[model samples]
Target: MSTRLRIALDAMGGDHAPDMVVDGADIARERCPNVDFLFVGDEQRINALLDARPALKAISQVRHTADVVAMDAKPSVALRSGRGSSMRLAIDAVASGEAASVVSAGNTGALMAMAKFVLKTLPGIDRPAIASMLPTMRGDCVMLDLGANLECDADNLVQFAVLGTVFAQTVLGLLEPTIGLLNVGSEEQKGHEAIRTAASALRATPLARNFHGFVEGTDIAAGTVDVVVTDGFTGNVALKTAEGTGKLFGEFLRRTFQSSLLAKLGYLLARTAFNKLRQRMDPRRYNGAMFLGLQGVCVKSHGGTDGLGFANAICVAVDLVQHGFNEKIRKELALLQESLQAASAAASGSDPQAVAQ
Candidate 1:
């Protein structure tokens, strides 16, 4: 919070890169004069985009580099040969201390691989998880390992819940964030061994007092849980399902309204209300993906993301920096781990499953 936050942006890494990344940068600079931005990508194309648009001409220039790692490129291979690739450079910039944060929409695997190499995990963390915000009925919950680590054990899940609670507090500003082990049912014995063991450990920890019991998929948006911890396989499935469902629902609504004049009139009257709802629920609004459990905050947007989306991701990274997200995660997890150990010692003679249920 003491220093100005500068974000290194991978301009060409997303689905809507360059334009989206550029526009988002412009928005951030205009909104917060204190926040500076640096874009990493093709010099000619980036300058051309800036040149063509008077709105962005006044902002900072792109840090020119020709290396580009295709979305499908292997993470290790990309790490070595990605060279000047915008994503690689952006992360490297952060590692070198030239940048406070990095934002990209490029390859998730590559991003995670590169980030782990550069930032490394905090002392207690085994791997950094990709945490994202999801709409919940009560409000929103931060879900982790959305796609970073595919096979997570009980310890990994426990770590996620701990770190996720820290994230919810720092970024989401939620005090005493409720942590939950994502499962198929609410029963204590619902999930596999990982869930069962993690639940027992979390509940036994002092911080476990802050953690709630198991939650199901329906609770994701109902806001029944503040933080949802699961393996990347499940988290990824949930994320994609939410996105697909939203898109399909939106398309359905548009199509239905277009079929008749009456529907059109209704849409017109509800346009503002609809837009408000859309903005609230839009993935674009919550576009940034956080690399949790790292020394610094690194965000990955959708590769095809536009300037606005990538820029928003940058803004998210800056916000994380300002909130001391990484430090908070370390502190909170230490507390949780200590609590777990003490509780274990005290209950060495007690029945765990009995206590858990």
Candidate 2:
């Protein structure tokens, strides 16, 4: 077993493959000196790019494989035929204990399907969630089930809350992260039975102090809670809406700046402020989406993102490994199970099956 912290990279998974992947590895190497990389893809192509960056070459190894997963491949097709592809092999490294985690900029569905099939879920988690950090008025907030499960039950929602809370504490470094269930409104009767049941269950748990009733769509940007939990369908729609809104706002600003000579002059004077805002809103800054509740760390980067964005994704994988994220999640989950079991026993006369149900 290797003593060094090794990350498996799907070198041919992105839009601007091999080159973008190699360049991103170089940048990540600079930021995380203690980390090493296992580049899994076409050896010749990867080496051709790495040859120029001897510094990156020293800390990385190229595992030769000619197969590559197509960006448009369906999850079922990819799983059935892409066994030797870069994405699948990279994930295999984590399962075989050759790497601490896997990072890929590939088809989201394929990646998730392969990861779940290979790595499986953690002890107390039934389904894994896709989670990412979102910029907010207060600071960065964690949101989960970005597009993992189309439909989720009350128990699934509760599990997502636990996952998001652990992520905030591990990566975001929040002491007691506040959690809220995304809903149509803040009122107790706003959503369906599942959301209400999940909310009620959370309120009864030991983590009740951190639960903040319910939150609406506006609350996501307002940073009403440190962690937001919801089913993947709703979460995915919300994420796309936010992205669209940001792009629309940027276009509006651009048009305003070019409207008149006076506007141009104002832009010149306020260039510094605009640049700061751009940096903060840069999508690359938040490229990594984690597959929470998995037994191993698996981060998915945007396929169209550039080297800088890919580097941020690698950083996310490294941070999770260094922080022992999975272990902490397991510990927190055990506590939640015990709390739930005790409550169920007290209410239903020692029926363990009641808690499971």
Candidate 3:
């Protein structure tokens, strides 16, 4: 009968299925003892796993669901016919106020579509964005629109900047985080019209104080800015390229260490350093990608991740909900709107069309 922070999980959505979901809940339970869970998936399989973890089972409830969204299923197909799916049911729990948020290691495209459809976008937010933090030498940096809207106008980019700012503040604990537009070059005259327009628009707002202008791909790793804003097509490519680079370097190190006996000896001498490097580069630490701008909190876990990764995703959801992320975004955006309106009134005698300039 205890009122706890509840999270809904799509128990059958991951590559590992009910086992991974149940195990993750167990791990997440240790980190977040106050949280309860609503697991939406095959009741029989889920219960069997839960029965083994009495502690997790004590705080969990299972809602039977047989339908599942395929990993490779088209977003359009899933959206039209995935109503009874575990992914959909879990999301529905959040929309109905039965859960504070939903976490799933499911199909990302389907999750985004269903979440936007069910929870709707926040007022003034035309589209939701996929945002997550990445490790940088200076610390972690937040980036957004990572595969959500491939094509974005100046307004959409501006909205992304707003969303990224709130995300960095609430999640990254950055005060007045610096914002930058991802571009081919750092020059003001570089990039396309949309980027140029967005940059000009940002300069007119209070965010201008922290806006750092255009940032190239290298700036992302250099931590030149706290938030990197780009269209989904560009952001997605950057994310994938970074991931691939990490893997390539890791492979190179492994091969180098095994190439000769002297190399093996050297690796042994530097084993502790290597272990630290491995931990620092671990992908599980950054497994959660939040679907920002939705009315409800929903986090997408990497489908290939193990229990630890999924648990991290659950923790991400917990952080967003606990910090009242959506409320903070609404408050920040309202203030931004008011500031724009005031500026418009002063500049053009309240000509609304002039504000877009």
Candidate 4:
């Protein structure tokens, strides 16, 4: 029998957990036929969803935990103190080699804490940055530190650029991903000290300099670069703002469509065009976020995400595994670490769980 892409999903971790998670599982099954899902959560609740559906009824389940960590709860507390929580189980499953990937639309912090504690980061990767795809003019470009690793230094940002570049090449299928330091200006010395420092380091480094430079906020959705690297503080804000703007603009379009009979007629005439725009801006399409710099694949979904978001996250997981993300990233990271060491004539390490100093 062919081996399935085994995945353990946190059914009770997200805002729409269990119900949305279950529906997402169904969506994945219908779409990614090669994947084998194992929902980890309350047995009765999972069974209730499974029993409600015929195809899903045949799917498997692993009743790992009985509790859940709320969205706002601190991840350290949840991962450390909340014993046997659903998110913990899912991360533990991947760490224990029980599954190939772990999908959590739950607490971002909680999920990251558990994954870092469990699967662990790849060697030489100081921290695992979460990179989510953005709806850019050219297509989807990656924006790093979406919510993971809130406090990052210049070195960490450089590492993210290295990681993001490989992610762009392998996952996004970019031939030579243009690396950009998310900055206030395109000038080399434009951002914070950390950013300016990172830009210099990035330029000096051979691996990252491949189609590399600096990018400003205006260049984000405009597609000036393939990868946008920045500290978590900046990157997360940029991502959220873009998300909010997209939603608000879409709402405006909908309101305008319903404002008047003339507008409604315009909508009818441009119905196909509007549908295309909707597809491009749909939050569901870019719902997946890869926890970059990890040894194995850990794709994070939005906690408030629903069935469609879940499906998109699953597709992200499948694509990464299918394209061998871990293996590819390993080489790139090693190259970066080695080059940094050689160039500086000193050991510069990116150790996971390393002190953030």
**Model 4, position 133: C-alpha lDDT score:** 88
Model 3: CA > 4 A from native: 1-3, 350-357
Compose the digit string of candidate 1's lDDT tens values, residues 1-357.
545667888888866667777787887777656677777999888898778767656656578888877889899998888866788888888889988889888898988888888888898899889999888778888999898989999889888887888889877898888888889999987989988998988877766777788888888878888999999999999989989988999999999989999999999999999999988987777888898988877998877666666667777787888888887777777887777766776679565555677
Which residue pairs of candidate 2 clash?
Answer: none
Backbone clashes (count) for model 4:
1
The residue-by-residue lDDT of candidate 3 on 3-116, one tens digit each, is 589999999888998788899999999999789999999999999999899999999999998999999999999999999999999999999999999999999999999999
Can you write out model 4's per-residue Cα lDDT over 70-181, one digit (the tens) per residue? Answer: 8899877987786688888887778778888888888888888878887888887889999988978898899897767777888898888888988898878998888888
| RMSD (CA, angstroms), candidate 1 | 4.0
Q: Which structure is stronger by lDDT: 1 or 3? A: 3
State candidate 3's TM-score.
0.96
* lDDT value, residue 128 of candidate 3: 96
Measured by TM-score, how close is model 2 to the native structure? 0.97
Indicate the worst ten consecutive residues by lDDT in candidate 4. Answer: 346-355
Better of 3 and 4 by TM-score: 3
Candidate 4: Cα lDDT at 270: 98
| Stretch of 10 with least lDDT, candidate 3 | 347-356
